[model samples]
Target: MIGKFLNRINELSMLRDNWNYEGAKPIHATVCRQAKALVVRLSENILKSLVVFPDVDGTLLFDVRSDNSHSTIFVCDNFFSYILKKKSGNNEVFSGCSWNKDSDVNAMISKIEDSLS
Candidate 1:
């Protein structure tokens, strides 16, 4: 479960870093795995530092500070078992990433289309 999360986060960071050389702005990325969540503070299209929770729980945490001290985001995220099982609230939003524990540590993350009010 965590391997995928790390890979995805790394992938995002790498993507941001790649964009950096070309003059793209850096973006923040948060990842959660086994109560160990990580928040990376990026600057000028590069990863500046990180904030990690070695022991934490719950869903959807965000870091709003400019320094990115320690907070969580409304990621609209949670965990479930499999494709056959669905127990989500109708009004809830999903981030479109699923981890198949039964299978390889591989996880699939998708870009979520959120409705802005």
Candidate 2:
């Protein structure tokens, strides 16, 4: 179970690394929102599969750190948000919201799978 959870985290990290949104502002925002939602869902599922306690809510916090940057995915309260800071400076590069639909989340997952090849 731990392995499966780690694999999912790795998959999400890979997706984050390979996500390239060169489109318009609205499109980029949509993609980012979807990706954040997917990350939250994946984290929640992993915690649910691992924890035995039924009331173990708010105790688990999953964060995915970037390998090449100061970006991070923070999962909380059934939502996930991404914060990206500049590599050379202490400034934020981008920050995404924390809401997305099921279809958007699934689409983001599909895009990640497609990037794996």
Candidate 3:
């Protein structure tokens, strides 16, 4: 279902301003591109329960939940932020920028894998 996630991300881009009935901004094109890139980097296992959507602030949001954990990754124009909640009640929260770099993408991939495990 990675395809499903990607499709949803694309759908989110069609949302208009105030789509949420609360004056929310539409999803930014840059944010959608960044989100799709991140999704493409995900492993199938981590993609299993992943859901992609947009936030009111024009960023993309990715959420994945396993039996013992839950995580969220927010994608903006050139950066990403994530919150990983572990089964043991510990949480990992961080943000990184610079989508033009391979290292940043790799770091996000690694963090996502850890969150899902």
Candidate 3: residue 84 lDDT (0-100): 82
Clashing residue pairs for model 3: none
| Stretches of model 3 off by over 4 angstroms after superposition | none
For candidate 2, lDDT tens digit of each residue in 1-117? 445554544443333222344321111233333334454555333334332110122212233333333333334343544444444445442223334455544543333232222
Give the per-residue Cα lDDT of candidate 3 at 97.
Answer: 53
Residues 1-117 of candidate 3 have per-residue lDDT tens digits of 767878998899999999999999999999988888788888998898788877999988888889878888888897777888888888888777568888877886787687666
* Highest-lDDT candidate: 3
- Every model's TM-score: 0.24, 0.31, 0.90
Q: Rate the local accuracy (lDDT) of all candidates.
A: 0.28, 0.36, 0.84
Query: How far out, in Å, is residue 68 in model 3?
Result: 2.1
Candidate order (lDDT): 3, 2, 1
